[model samples]
Target: MESELKIVTFNIGKDKFGLDIMKVDAVIEYEEATTLPNTSDYFEGIINYRNEEVLPIINLRKKFRMPDFDDKTLAKVIVLKMDERKVGIMVDDVKNVRSINQDLIDEKPKIGGIRQADFISGIARLEDGMLIVLDIDKLITKEEKIAIDEVVTD
Candidate 1:
C-alpha cells in the first residue's frame, strides 16, 4: 500500500534518504563494474548479477553530480526491477531498513538543490531526520537507460 512504505535508508552525501524496499530487488557491494562509454555520467556501468546482464547502475554521487566513485568509499548497488526489467542504484553508504506510515510521509518541500524534485516520492519524517523517499520508477526510463552491449570490464 502507498500508505505503508518499507524504506531502506542510505547515505547520499550529507543528507539522509530512503527508498521503498518494494522497488528493491537486491543490494550488492561495488565491484569491478563494466564501463559504458558515451553514457550519462550517472550511469557507472553494467553489473552481472544472477546471470543477467543489467544495464547501467546509477551512482547516486554522480547522479547528483557529487563525486567520482573511488575504491576507498565502497557502495552498495540497490537493484530494482520495473516493467520486467532490472536496474541498480549505488549509494555512498547503506544506513538502515525501516518502515513509515503514510501520515509520516509528506509531499516534497519546495526547497530544492538536487534534480527533479518530482522524482522524490515524499519526505518521510523519521525520529532522527527527514528521509528523502525516492520514486525509483520515475528516476529512470527506457530512453534514459544507457545501453551496455559493448561495455568492457576492467
Candidate 2:
C-alpha cells in the first residue's frame, strides 16, 4: 500500500529541515525559557502552554556544540505531544507545511563530524531546493528527558 506524509518545514542555523507534521501541533513565538537545574546541555527547560506545563525546548546551537545563547538570536518553539503531555521544540523559526509521498524521499549522504547526519531520515528535493528530513521520534527518548525546575514557580 502507498502512504502519504505531511511534513513541517523549518530552519536551524542556515540549513532547511523538515519533520513529519504528525509530530507537531503548532508553532509559537520564542519567549523566555524557564531554566532548569543540572540537566543535559540540550535541555533549555519548560514553559506554560494554555495552563498546561510543558518543556520549553533545546536549542540547535547547544545541540551542535556551539556556545551558550545570547539575547540577539531570535527563536521559536515547535509544540509536540507525548501522549497527553505537551512539549516544545526550539528551532530558529517555523517555515511551512508540505506533503511528500513515502517513495519520493532520497537517501542522505554519509558524513562525519555531525552525528545528526545519521539522524536524517532522507533528503527531500522540493521545487526550490533540498530539505533534510528528520526522524523526530528518535530525536530523543523518555529516559533522556530531564525535568526542569523553574525558580519563580517551583
Candidate 3:
C-alpha cells in the first residue's frame, strides 16, 4: 500500500500551497484583527476565536514577499496547531483537502530570489497544477519566533 499524506490546500495570490492536515485545526472566514504595534509586517494581529481563544493572524503573502491583496479581496484564515498554540494564517482563498501519495512529492528545489522558499517542504504534482507543500515549523525564523512569543505572552 502506498503511503498517503493528507493536506489542506490554500492560495496566496495565484500560487497554490498545501499544509499537512494533521497540523490544521480549522478553516475559518477572515475577520478583522486588532492591529498591534512593533510587530512584524506579516503579523496581521490577533482575533478572538469562538469567544475562547485569541488567535494571531499572519499574512502569508507578506511573509513570502508576494503581492498583497486588497482589503476587498476575499480571504480565509487557516488555523494551525503549532507548539501547543494556534496560529491563524490568512490566505487569498482556501481550496480543499487532498490526499497525495508520499512518492508523488518532490523535494523542494533551490529557487534563488524567492523569499520563504526554504519553508517549502516539497512540491506535489496534481492533475490541475503543482502544489507547494509547506513545512509550517520552518516558516518562521528564530528571531521572528521570539518576537511573536513576546507579543503573544503580553
lDDT of each: 0.74, 0.71, 0.87
Which tens-of-lDDT digit does each residue in 35-99 have in candidate 1? 76687777777767777655457777876667765652477778887665677788878887887
Q: Per-prediction RMSD in angstroms?
A: 3.3, 3.4, 1.6
For model 1, give the RMSD to the true fold: 3.3
For residues 1-154, what per-residue lDDT tens digits would candidate 3 score against the true structure?
A: 7599999999888899999999999999988888899998889999999898888899988888877768724789999888867889999999899999998899997778776467899999888999999999988666776777789779
Ranked by TM-score, the better of candidates 1 and 3 is 3
> Between candidates 1 and 3, which one is better according to lDDT?
3
How far is 138's C-alpha from truth in model 1 (Å)? 0.9
Clashing pairs in 1: none
| Best-matching candidate per TM-score | 3
Q: Number of clashing pairs, model 1?
A: 0
lDDT by residue for model 2 (10-120), tens: 877777888988878778887777777866788776677767565557676677566654652478788875554556777887888888877778887767766655558
**Clash totals for all candidate models:** 0, 0, 0
Model 2, runs deviating above 4 Å:
1-3, 66-73, 113-118, 146-154
- CA deviation > 4 Å runs, candidate 1: 70-73, 112-115, 146-154
Candidate 2 residue pairs that clash: none
Error of 2 at 119 (Å): 3.0
Worst 10 residues of 2 by lDDT: 145-154
lDDT-best of 2 and 3 = 3
